[model samples]
Target chain A: MVVQNSKSNILIVEDEKGLRLGTQRLLEEEGYAVSAAENGNEGIKLGTSKEFDIAVIDLRMPDIDGLEVLKEIKNVYPNTVCFIATAFASYETAIQATRIGAYGYIPKPFTPEEFIYQIEQGIKQRELILSAERLKKEREENLFELASEKSRLNAIIKSINEGVLVLNKNGELAYYNYAALKYLNIREINIGENVIDKLPSKIVAVVKTIFSNDTFLLKTYTVQIEIKPNNELILEAACTPVPHPDGSLAGVVVTLGNITEFKKIEVIKSQFVSMVAHEMKTPLAAVQGFLNIIVDDTINVEKEKRKDYLKRSIVRLKSLTDLVNDLLDISRMELRTKHREIENIKVKDILSNVLQMLELEIKKKNITVQKNIEEKLPAIQADQNDITRIISNLLSNAIKYNKENGSIGIKLGSSPNYLILQISDTGIGMKPEERSKLFSEFYRIKNDRTRGISGTGLGLSIVKRIVESYHGKIEVDSQFEVGTTFTINLPINLN
Target chain B: MALIAIIDDDIDILDASSLVLKSKGHDIVTATNTTDGYKIVKERKPNLIILDVMMEEPDDGFYLAQKFRKDGIKIPILMYTSVSKAIGMEFDKSEIVPVDDFVEKPISPEELVEKVENLLHLKEVK
Candidate 1:
C-alpha cells in the first residue's frame, strides 16, 4: 500500500538524543517534512531562519529552556504555530507553555497518531491567521485613500471668497481659510491662536458663552469689528458645533460674510424717505395755514389782511420752488452733470452780496450782525456760484434759527496756507445726534420746526460736497439751545 | 419830507411797499427791475432805498446793492426780501442781510410802517 504524503513541515526540538531522533522519524513516516534540534539553543536558531508549519519541543531541555525558546520563536515569527511535548505532564508546565504562545502541550508516552493530529491542527490555524492579516492590510489602504480625497476637497472649499474658520475643543483656532484671513486682517502668527486673544472683548464674551454651553447652537450672529489698519468691518457670521460619534463636543465651525456696504445703503434709503416727507410737509403746512387765515371771517376783511394772506402764499410758493431746486442740485451733484466754472472771486464781495440778499429778514428780526472781514483778504480761485451758494446756505441757517434779539458774528482771516471764514450764531443750537447727521442729505434737527424755519435739508449736504470738491474742510461746533458755529478752511490760492 | 425809492422784481411787493411808505406820508418811487431801479436811484437820489433780494435773478438785488455801495450811493438801503428773517444768520452786530432794516415776506403793514418810521427817524438824527 502507498503512504499518503503530507505537505506540513514540522520541527522536533529535544535535548535527549533518543527522544529527538524518535519524534523526527515518526513525523517523517507520517508524511511530514521534519527537522530535529538537539537543544533549545539550536531550536531558536532554526525557528528564526526557517518558516516552519509546526514547532514541537520537549518541555525540559538543556541550555535556553523550552518555554524560553518558544517565546523567542513567537517574537520573531508571530505566525509560526508552536506545541510542547513534556514527560513531566505537570499542569503548571502545560499552562506556562500555552501562556507563552504555544498551540498545545502533550504528555510523553503519547501515540504517534496523536502527535501527528496536533501538528496538523497547528499548521491549519497558522494559515487562517496569515490570510486574516492580509485582508486587514487591504482595508486600511482603502481607508487612507478615502481620507486623502476628503482632504483635497476641503482645501478647495477654503479658497472661496466667504470666510471660514474652525475652532478646536480648547477654543483655539484650528484652521482658517485665506478669505477669513483677509477679512479679519489676520496675520500668519494668529493662526492656531486662542480665539479670545484675537477677537475684541465684546466678541470674545459671545464666543465664550457659546463654547461653554454644549446644548446651544448659535447659528447666526451679526457683529461689527474694526479690523487692522482701522477699517470698519461688518460681518454676518454663522456658527455650528462639530460633535464626536459618542455625542461629545468636538469643535466649532464659523463662517463670516462682509456686510459693510449693505448697511450704508440701508441708512441712505431711510434718510431719503424722511427728507421727502419733511419737504412735502413744510409747504403743505404753510399753504394750509394761510388758507385758514383767509377763510376766517372773524378777522376783518381789510386790505391789509388780504395783502398779508397773498404775500404769505407767495412765500410758500417760493419755498416749494427752493425745495425743488435743492433736489435738482443734489441729483446734479451725484450725476456729476454740473461743471465748475472756476474764476477769481473776491471773498469780501461775496460775503457782502450774501448779506445784502438777506438784509430784509435780518433787519426785521432786530438781530445784531457784526462783520470782521479783512480788507486785504486774498481772492480765492473757485467756482464763484458754488462759493456764493455755500456762504448763502450757512448764513441763512444762522438767521433762520436765531432767537429774538439774537446776534450773528462773521470773521474772515487768512493763515499761511489757508483762508478761513467763521460764522457763529446765537440760535437754537444742535444736539450731538443732530450735529452728527447735520451734513447728511435730508437730515434736519427736529426742533427746527418750532422756529417756523424752512429749508430743503440739502443745504449742508451740498455745502459739504462743494467744500470737498475744493479740497476744503468745514468744522461745526454747537451746544444745544446755546449757540452754533461753522468754521470753513479753504486753500488760499489755487495757482 | 423824506423820499424813499423801492426796487423789487415783484410788482405786488413794490406796490405794497410804496403804499406803506406813502401812507406814512413819505414820498415814494418804485422800480420793477435792476436797470430801472439803478437809474431811478442815480437820478432821484432818494433818502432811503428798499431793495428786494430775489429779482428776475436770485442775486440781482445783491448785485444792485454792491453797485450802489461802489458808486458812493450812501442812502441807507433797507433790503426787503421774501426770504424769511428767521432764516437770516446774524454775525456780530451786523446781520447776514446787509441793510439798515429788513422785513420778511407776507409783511404786516403795521410792521412795515414801524420799521420805515424808525429808519427815517434814525436818518434825521444822523
Candidate 2:
C-alpha cells in the first residue's frame, strides 16, 4: 500500500556531458538510482516519469532554462525535491529557484564531496516531505471512515422499533436513539451530561437499577414501567452492559419496547375465544337436552313430540354451523384479505342478484320493497364475492327485522369518487347507544321482539369487515321504534 | 305461577332459557335488551330477573342492575355470564353490579332451575 523503492532515484539535468556523467556516477556509488538528462526539457520529462526523489538541474541549458524546468517539474510532481547549479553568481535566479521549491543551490566549482553532500541533503528533504504527505492522506481517510461509521450507526438506531439509551462509565448520556427521544419526550440533549436528571421519572428508575453496581455482570436485565397523566403506555425496558475494549464495564444500553398494542390484541383474542366457546356450547347443550328428553322412558313419549324435539335440535345445530362458518370467514379475512381478486362489476347487477336470493323471505314477511337506482351507476373495482356478501347481509337484515307489511326503501347512486348505497327499513329499530356496538363481532340486539328472530349474529360484522377490506365506509342512522337506515359508500377506485 | 323476566342479547339464548323456565311451569316475561328489560320490570314487576352479563355492551347487565337498584326494585337478579371464569375477570355482587348471583352460560337446565329457585327463595326470605 506504500509507494516505496529499494534505492532512491535521482535525475541530473546538466548541458555539460562530463558534469552529467560525473554526477550520475557519484550518485550511483552512493547507492542511489541515477538517471542523466542532457537538457532542461529532458530533465523535466525524466523528473516526472521516473519517480525520482530529487532533481539536480544546471541554471544554464541549451533548450529550457533551469528556472523554467524547476517550475515545470514542481507543477507536475510538486513533491520531487530540486537543486540548482550555476557557474555565474546571479541573485535573481537564486531567489526565483527557491520560490519554485528548490532544495538548495550548488556552486559551479564545487568539490566532488561538496556536490555529494548537497545531493544527500536534497534526498533527505524529499524523504521528510513524502512522509508528511503520507501522514496527511492517512488522517483524511480516518476522518471519512469515522463519518461513515457514525451515519451507519445512526441509521441502525433509527430503524429499530425499540427505544435505546446508552450511558458512559460516568453515568452520563453517551447516545440516545430516535425512539428514545420519542418515548422519553426529550427535545434536546447534551452529550456526556448526567441522564438521570433529564429522563422522565419512570425511565430514570429503570436506568438506575442497572447503573447502581459495577459488579452487575448480567448481560441483560428487563423491567416493566408505566407512563401516565396523558396516555397510559406500558413500556418494557431491557438494559444490557457494554464492555470496553479492555473488557471493563464501559456503558449500558437500554432498549424500551412499547407493548400496549400487543397487550390489546391479546385481550381481544382471548375474548373472541371465550365468545366462540360459549356460543358453541349453547347449541351443544340444547341438542343434548333434547336428546335426553326424547329417550326418557318414564314420560309418555309421543312420536310427533319426539319429532318436534329433533327438529329444534337440527335448527340449533344449523345455527351453530353458521357461527362456525362466520368464524372461518373472519380468520380467512384476517389472513391475506388484502390480496383479493379485483374485477370491474356493475352495482345494479349485484343488487338484483341479492334481491332475487331474498325474494322468498321478502314475500313471507309481506314487506313492500322499493328501489331507486341511478340509471348509469359507475362500476367499482372490488372482489365480487365480498360485494355480494355485503349486499346480501344488508338486505337479509332489512327483511328479517321489518314489521309485517312494512315498507323498505333502497337507493343507489354515485358521487365523484364513491358509489353510494342506502337501505332504509321500517323495522324494529334500535336506540342511539346500541348503534355503536352494532358492528362489533357477535353483537345482536336483544329484546322480546328480536328474541324470536333467528340469526348467526355475525352477519353484520362480516359485512363490515368486507366493506373495510375494500377501503369503504359504512354508516347507520336509526330511531327507536321508528325505522333504521344504512348508508354504504364504496370507493370507485382503489388507491 | 311466579313471573320471571329473561333478558339477553342473543335471541337463541333467550329462546332456550325462556323455554327452560316456561317448562318449569312458571310464567316467563322476556326482554332482549336493557331498555326493554327495565321497562318490563317497571310495568309487570316480575318476581325475579335473569340478566345476561354481556349484551350489546360489555357492561349492559351492570348498568341495568344499577338502574333497578336506583328504582328501589328489590327483585333478585340472576346474571348469566357467557364469559368463562378461567379468563380471570371477576364481577361479583357490588354497588356497580348489584346482582344476587351469576350463572355460567350454556347452562344445564337443572343448574338454571336450581339457581333460579335459590335466588327466588332468598328474595322471599328478604
* Index of the highest-lDDT prediction: 2
| Model 2 CA lDDT for position B65 | 92
The TM-score of chain B in candidate 2 is 0.93
Which candidate tops TM-score? 2
Write model 2 residue lDDT over A230-258, tens digit each, in one string. Answer: 33677777888888878777888889899
In candidate 2 the C-alpha lDDT for residue A408 amounts to 90
DockQ agreement of candidate 1 with the native complex: 0.02
Model 2 clash pairs?
A: A446-B32, A446-B33, A447-B32
lDDT of 1 by residue, A63-181 (tens): 87899989998899877789988888888888888888998887787887887778778767877776777789899999999998989878886778788888877878887888887
The lDDT of model 1 is 0.76
- Give the range where candidate 2 chain A is weakest over 10 consecutive residues by summed lDDT: A292-301
Q: What are the lDDT scores of the predictions, listed in order?
A: 0.76, 0.83
